[model samples]
Target: MSEGTAISDASASRAASSSAPLAERYAEAMIPVFGTPQRVLVRGEGCRVWDDAGRAYLDLLGGIAVNALGHGHPALVDALAKQAPQLAHVSNFFATEPQIELAETLLSLAGAPQGSGVFFANSGTEANEAAFKLARRHGGAERPRILALENSFHGRTMGALALTSKAAYREPFAPLPGGVEFIPSGDTAALEAALAPRDVAAVVAEPIQGEAGVRPLDPAYLRALREATRDTGTLLILDEVQTGIGRTGSWFAHQGVEGVVPDAMTLAKGLGGGFPIGAMIAFGPEVRGLLTAGQHGTTFGGNPLGAAVALAVLGTIREDGLLEHVRTLGESFAARVLALGDPRITEVRGAGLLRGIGLAEPIAPQVAAAALEAGFIVNAPDPSTIRIAPPLVITDQELGSFADALPALLDAAAPAAAGAAAPVDPSAAPAADDKDPS
Candidate 1:
């Protein structure tokens, strides 16, 4: 039988056996990590996905900002198909052309100066771990503390977890790597005070805080941070895992702001369109060589398959001029949503394709469920925020449909109370899980 036929038969057999029910099958076969599968998504094309029951929904979350080119773009498919059979995995002892090319491409896109380097990893967490090690190496023994913002999120690994500010995520995983401090996100004074002593090895920040309801740090504050860190000799690390790769109308979100560059930047999410790939791009000799040899490694970090896929993703973004497209569409979409003037929608936050709708009450979970039922998929990162990081390929018409549907969705989620607020009980809002769709 052909390879396609064999795969089809395998999928048929698995689906036949799991007729017991989607939830039951998941419960029996998988760990209770993500609570429950939101939907048994079976197929996708462009910005739309289909569930097993044949329901279609507009995918606004874009796999939490990982699907830059959207589901199964021809370029991405061609790249994976051409590269996988030829050279998929080779140990780190040897480097492939695609791997080297990808590294060069990322550095070029980041506009890093000479003597810069990159460390590849499989996820955002690993990339952040590498950055953490670089910070420690640069700081030495005396300046040990690593500083991150109050509403920031790096990743889930031990070192990255230490830098994350959410109590619920960090408290459970206590005794984590020490020497991490949390400062307010947009407070330049607080940052200056924290870095005044020069005891900080690094100051890590997300140009836009994704998990904390898509809060963007003020650009002036970021410039101030650059100045403060420079004066104190502290490294500035930007976590662009969710905001990079043309998602925010630039190669990196920090680039949208003027005259602010980081010592190191962590990128993953959309770097490979949908394939898993992460990288830490360190600028200057001081930050680049800190890792050295044998300090850190990953078996599948920069494999030929991922590298080829990432190169294709980058090429597509550049050739298609998606950066300008995202900026235009994003501004229009945000304006349309805000113009609805729904009482429930308090504010619309974020830039480019990454957006968050802040609600007047804590009914985000209900709003999300209502949206799902209304043939749309969105994320409630917090109890009162709805985040929309749709595929860059999403068209203006598709976004308009969601915008037209927003007011009704909010009404269905919570009927407006003239003087009373929506019920705010513990059970009313579910705790956000590890798979943060930020």
Candidate 2:
């Protein structure tokens, strides 16, 4: 490299760190794992967040489905405010009411059978990491193989990354703990064939593969997984990191369907309504016993503060009937978007508020960029799919605003040469998955 270029780069970094801008300073201080920040958001309320520049954008992504109650909801704030003043945390040697209560509530909501158990962690990957250990323990030396699905995203930790199918995410950390295999998603035959040997330990899947363009697995396919895994004595682990915690209008997305109960399930993301908390539920005593005492532990997994907040989030969802609202709004949400008759949109995929607006062409990145410019926030999970997971508390009017602006967003994103537009009359309003569970 030239000395002049090196010196120039160093100067630029120094300037950015000094006082250039919040985003520039972020680049100077943080690693480039996420590439760049779309905006330097300072604060948020309800379904909107304000950037450092003071511009407000509708938060359609809802922090990628983590902000279940939107922002600054009194339930969450009060829960933390109250809990922090009380017993905020306790060592694992002892227990707390909030933690125990949260576990019971989650079990009841999940319809977990008698003798089920819950293990808490700080994030989804940690939960999956625990699930991975359980799977290995269940398999022991004889049944060492584990199976995951193609286009699946478990999490980012090494164990979870091993279960994740994307080559890009798993390749860099090559030689990840082995015995993990990927099969065609939604393919019943492949699932059966893979389990024929009865040598696999556990099969992990997401009801809706959120990171993989929000594609939802078929309910029938999930049922097949349950039957096959059960027949082979293999554990069925559902990764509901994105679908659980009422994001899909239910305790878990799988509950919206029927006859697809997993032997174990992973949870996080919206569980604490933006607070860091993750959980793995063992469906019955047998599976729960897989992880005996001292086999695994965490210091702050079920801290009272996070537990209290999660309880409040769950309680508010039930009290406010957000699940039914999400369900009704989700159906209408799809129809309304299609009613526009815009040729660019292919279909709305996913269950409840967890949706992906599939495009006719690979213009999702451009559309996401245009969305931000138009005072809206969405993400392109894939080149052809725009993911929108607005807070469960989001209203029809708020979503209608985005729907009303969708055409302009698409227009600005599409190639200029692709001409001729259709008239769209978006009547503002609200109305209205996958692997069967519960």
lDDT of 2 by residue, 3-106 (tens): 99999999887876786788878897898999998888888888888777776778899888999999999999999999999998899999999999999999
> Local distance difference test, per candidate?
0.89, 0.89
- Tens-place lDDT digits, model 1, residues 143-201: 98899999888888899999999998899989999999898878888898999888899
How many steric clashes between backbone atoms does each model show?
Answer: 0, 1
The estimated TM-scores of all candidates read: 0.91, 0.91
Give candidate 2 misplaced runs (Cα > 4 Å).
Answer: 1-19, 416-438
Cα RMSD (Å) per model? 7.2, 6.8
Q: What is the lDDT of candidate 2?
A: 0.89
Clashing pairs in 2: 328-432
| Alpha-carbon deviation at 178 in model 1, angstroms | 0.2
